[model samples]
Target: MGLDTPRPRAAARHPARSSPPRRSLHGLSGPPPAHERTPLIRSCHMTHRSRRQRMHPTNTPSRRADSPIESLWPHRYSGVMISIVIADDHGIVREGLKRLLEVEPEFEVCGEAKNGREVLDAVERSRPDIVVLDITMPHLGGLETLERLRNEYGDTKVILLSVHNDPTFIQSAIGLRADGYVLKDGRAEEIVTAIREVMKGGSYFSPAVAKKIVEQARSPKSKSSDPFTLLSAREREVLRLIADGLSAKEVATELSISTKTVEAHRTSLMRKLDVRKATELVRYALRHGLIEP
Candidate 1:
């Protein structure tokens, strides 16, 4: 009778139904599929490559073992070498200067010339940063060559190398805007210092030359009364050739001028120098240091 409401049929026993398996955001997976992992692998590889590049830059230069200065001051030189051209009438002198200059790691002697004409040729060919020019050379003198260089190649720096420490020579160099003047008799180091100074947008003069310049500056009478200053560059060239014993035709050939033009220059030189005969011209040239005596 307690058959009761039949005990509600003992609440029919129904097995609990299991909930559906949970799923991650990627998918129902422990490890993602190959396609899903591809982006992550690429990102990791890119990060590692960037870190390697940061550790070792491509443009870094290896240390130079040859030059202590270069190694000590790596940022000073900018890795560019200075080009130089040396011109002298003497083979021995040119060789000596070449050896002296090549000692510097930054200096490269691009070419060598035995005289003023060759100096011009070398400059045209090489376009060097500097020209070390001897004052006296056959066919064309250093001063004339410097004039041509100043007109044609304004960027090229000129340094006069000369045996003459005369104030006249110094004055002429200054007037022509020469970058430096170093006496040949001075120490070989003087030329080296001159090149360095000139490259720095400064000028250099040998101690003796400097002293002469100062002396001349102080002396009002040193205004260069020497008739040599009166002659034009062409006249000077003609005078030098005549004094060197070249005939008028030979002088014409050397100068690439007609015989009549050579004669005209000769005449002009004589008038400016107040001379009469060819012998007088030779004497004047010798006295003025135009030709080697």
Candidate 2:
């Protein structure tokens, strides 16, 4: 035991103690003072704040002031609304067309008319970009209205809407420089597409109408047998009115013509159509689409 004492005081006996229980920051009364905080904790707070700032930046990009037109109508004419006037003899037809056209953001229906006479008034008042006109309106026919518009408002585009796909009607519209021809029986989208095409400085026709036009172009004699083509515009107007059961005096008043002139037109119509009686004239007008049956 003598030299063993030098061997180490038998390594002093000590009680085995478990590791101290871990303490969470949340469980603490408060965070340690800033200087007492560990570099790792401070670094974590700074990193979290930096990440939040990066995710939700305060600044936003600015929009250009001169891009309103580009933003509104990126695919169409810059900044311009395509103004339109719809003319149809039937109120329901006009209402339907208005409702259909109003859906397009770029289209604006500026005016409406029930007949060709009102069409002129609407065009004068609104100065619209396009006119969708019906062919067989009362008082003034569509072809006559188109001619007047071509003369008065040369810049305004005209699209003819007709139920007839006859070559005579198509040729007449083409001759009058109609920008488009859309049949009433066509799909509703056809009219919308026609307006867009006409606005683009191009022409559009229903497939049937286009085919009729091509047929007429190929055969000039196709319309010769149709006696309706032999009638003058004034004579046609007289026939339509006469067929509607208007007397010579009423026709004169409606047309602002003398009764004698109306009688003369009646005679011309009868001679051209080879009809002797007023009843026959009505039948012919009905058969030839001069008046609504």
Candidate 3:
């Protein structure tokens, strides 16, 4: 005899729809129960609500819904249209900033997110050169988002906007290597200046925040070494230009030096300041008043 064979398991059938073999229609059909009817009706209602999941490319951080069009508003700026990502949880704030930046020739708000969780996705999806985010966003706060950005989105620089200029927040942002900071209540001109400064690869602190930095300079906690003092005036100029957003090639072109020479200056600057990224070197330059604010 063949090895003892086991019968195959029957396929499961839905009790609601499966009819008993040769059963009368009366046994299989009925008016739906109240609970079952509720689900069917509810699902139909849900279908209406889920017709579309539109995204507003320039909607900013507080918009409850998106218009599904990217940059539905054309923007004019003084310089080249530098695409930007602005994040906050407030619609008015986002729209206001976008409108403000759009007035500058060189800036445009390409994407806006309402919270930190949306920052990365917005950055990646939008490919903005700069991400201007609120420091205290929900889901992920500004500091954490900055860290994530540095590690995960290396090329996109971050600018933190907040109402507070607390030393702790600034220090943490600097520690994480933020590219820029501005007060939410700061002047519109200051915000524009910040975008330009950061775009040129320099970090900016608003006037009040700058005062906090100056205070740090006078504090006993100051590091004993002064790196800026070590640089020659010429090297310092090159550093400023580099921080101002000119590539080594552009700086070299402007200064009439070999690209190699510009690279040497950058390398030396980094070494003298004990900083790693180009942005940090720029910050070091700005912090010392080597460059205009």
TM agreement with the true structure for every prediction: 0.72, 0.72, 0.49
As a whole number from 0 to 100, the lDDT of residue 61 in candidate 1 is 49
Error of 3 at 182 (Å): 0.5
Considering TM-score, which of the candidate structures 1 and 2 is the better prediction for this target?
A: 1
Model 2, 174-276: lDDT tens digits are 8779999999998999999999888778999999988887787688788786887776667877888899999999999998989999998898888888989
| Shift in Å, residue 128, candidate 2 | 0.8
User: Roughly what TM-score does model 1 have, to 2 decimal places?
Assistant: 0.72
Residue 141 alpha-carbon offset, candidate 3, angstroms: 0.7
Ranking by TM-score: 1, 2, 3
Worst 10 residues of 2 by lDDT: 37-46
Cα shift from native, residue 181, model 2 (Å): 1.0
Candidate 1, superposed: residue stretches over 4 Å from native: 1-78
